[model samples]
Target: MAQEPDPERLRALEARLAEAKGSKAKPAAAGKDFSQAEVAWRMVLELTSGIMIGGSIGYGLDYLFGTRPILLIVFLLFGFAAGIRTVMGTARDMQERQLRAQAIETQAEHSAGTEG
Candidate 1:
């Protein structure tokens, strides 16, 4: 013979399922609040990638020409300098934009106070 589920148990299970479905889960935090050190770390990673890529290309050229060490060293140093400059420039630009925003906000507040 077949058996039926108890109505009370079925109701309780339904309630639990409904509650679970209705609850909202928080979104995971992305790495948006990176500190200066962390930003530098990321910059270093980019620099390292650039160095590796440039070195690889240089290695290929050197192998074709039978020259060693010269091309790899030059390209890696160039890549490192370029990466540091790019990162520093970005940090500066971010600071400038923030300053401009603050200035605009201050101006607005001053104007509003004068008017009212």
Candidate 2:
């Protein structure tokens, strides 16, 4: 048979659980600190995937038409172009988001200052 639980320990556990629940309401201050390496990897993958997809399509077309090199080269170039375009877009988007975030933070500070 199992021993009875200790009442004092059970109350302590309950209090700890309550404290944890209360702490969950506060927003994390460091949550915005995303890793630069992670963003770099994401950009690299996007560029490579675009290139790979273009190459694959070109290869398929070349095989179908029995024009081995021409279609493949054309498609590879197109894919590289597409990847460049995507990377440019990603950079622009990241810049816009960063600007927006800064604007919001600035506005919040302004409001807080006025209210105080």
TM-score of each: 0.55, 0.69
lDDT of 2: 0.85
Colliding residue pairs in candidate 2: none
lDDT, candidate 1, at 12: 83
For each candidate in turn, give its C-alpha RMSD to the true structure in angstroms.
Answer: 11.6, 7.4
Across 31-98, the per-residue lDDT of candidate 1 in tens digits comes to: 24447787678777877877777788778878888889888788778777777777788788668766
Tens-place lDDT digits, model 2, residues 1-116 = 99999999987887787798874233446356456787788789989998999999999999999999899999999999999899999889778878978997899889889999
Leading candidate by lDDT = 2
Taken over the whole model, the C-alpha lDDT of each candidate is 0.75, 0.85
